[model samples]
Structure formats: structure tokens, C-alpha cells
Target: TDLNWPEEPIYKEYREAIKAKYQIDRLMKKRPNSRISIFAKIQAAEENLAQSQAGENNSDFDEEIPF
Candidate 1:
């Protein structure tokens, strides 16, 4: 019996990071009155996501949870 659960997405760390990056980018784009330009934020997010995907930093960003 293989103890490793290949079917579980959570078992893959990169998947979780990608999911978080997508959610953060989506939220950042939705803010209407943010101090920084939406385009800038998006660009920053892209860079951050790239860094994360490269197995660098994995910092958590603020995301709104739908109730």
C-alpha cells in the first residue's frame, strides 16, 4: 500500500501556492479605491507568483472569504 496520497491536491505544495496567488490577484483587481494603481498591483502579483512558483517565497496575502 502506498502511503503517499497522490489524489489529494493539498499534498502538492505548489498547487496550494498557485491557488493562493490566483485568489490574491483576483481580490487585488476588485478593489476600486486602492492607493496603488490596479495595473501595478497586478504586475506585482505576477512577479510574486512567479517567485513563489520558482520555490522562493510563499508569503500569505489578504483575501476576502465569502460568507
Candidate 2:
């Protein structure tokens, strides 16, 4: 039997980091106060989220596989 348990802390931290990165990216954009700049921030956040999630998923996969 397989159990799907969510790692709340890891997930929460990942989300928070993404949010903060987005905010910082926005502030660094060509027009910091523009709506279009927010899109850039979102893109940056998405990349960061993907990397973080990939790392977490890889660790989980490793834990499940036996050598």
C-alpha cells in the first residue's frame, strides 16, 4: 500500500520563498511599479518553484527506490 502524505512545512516554505522572490524580481524589473513587471516576477517565481519542487520530488523518489 502506498500513502500520499503532504510535507506541509516544505510546501509552505517553498510557496513563501516563491512569493518573496517574485516581489524582489518585480522590484528589479525595468518598471518596478508597472503591472507588466509583475508578470516578469511571476515568471521568475515559477522557475524558482519548479526548481524547488523538482528537488523535493527527486528526494522523495530516491527514498522510495531501493538500491
lDDT of 2 at 10: 49
How far is 53's C-alpha from truth in model 1 (Å)? 0.1
> How many steric clashes between backbone atoms does each model show?
0, 0
Deviating ranges (above 4 Å) for candidate 2: 1-33, 61-67
RMSD of each: 23.1, 22.9
Instruction: Give model 1's clash tally.
Output: 0
Compared with the true structure, what per-residue lDDT tens digits does model 1 show for residues 14-67?
666665867866776767656558778999999998987766334433344454
Over 1-67, each residue of candidate 2 has an lDDT whose tens digit, in order, gives 1135455544767666765867855666746467777888999999999999989977867678888
Query: If scored against the real structure, what TM-score would every candidate get?
Result: 0.30, 0.39
Against the true structure, whose lDDT is highest? 2
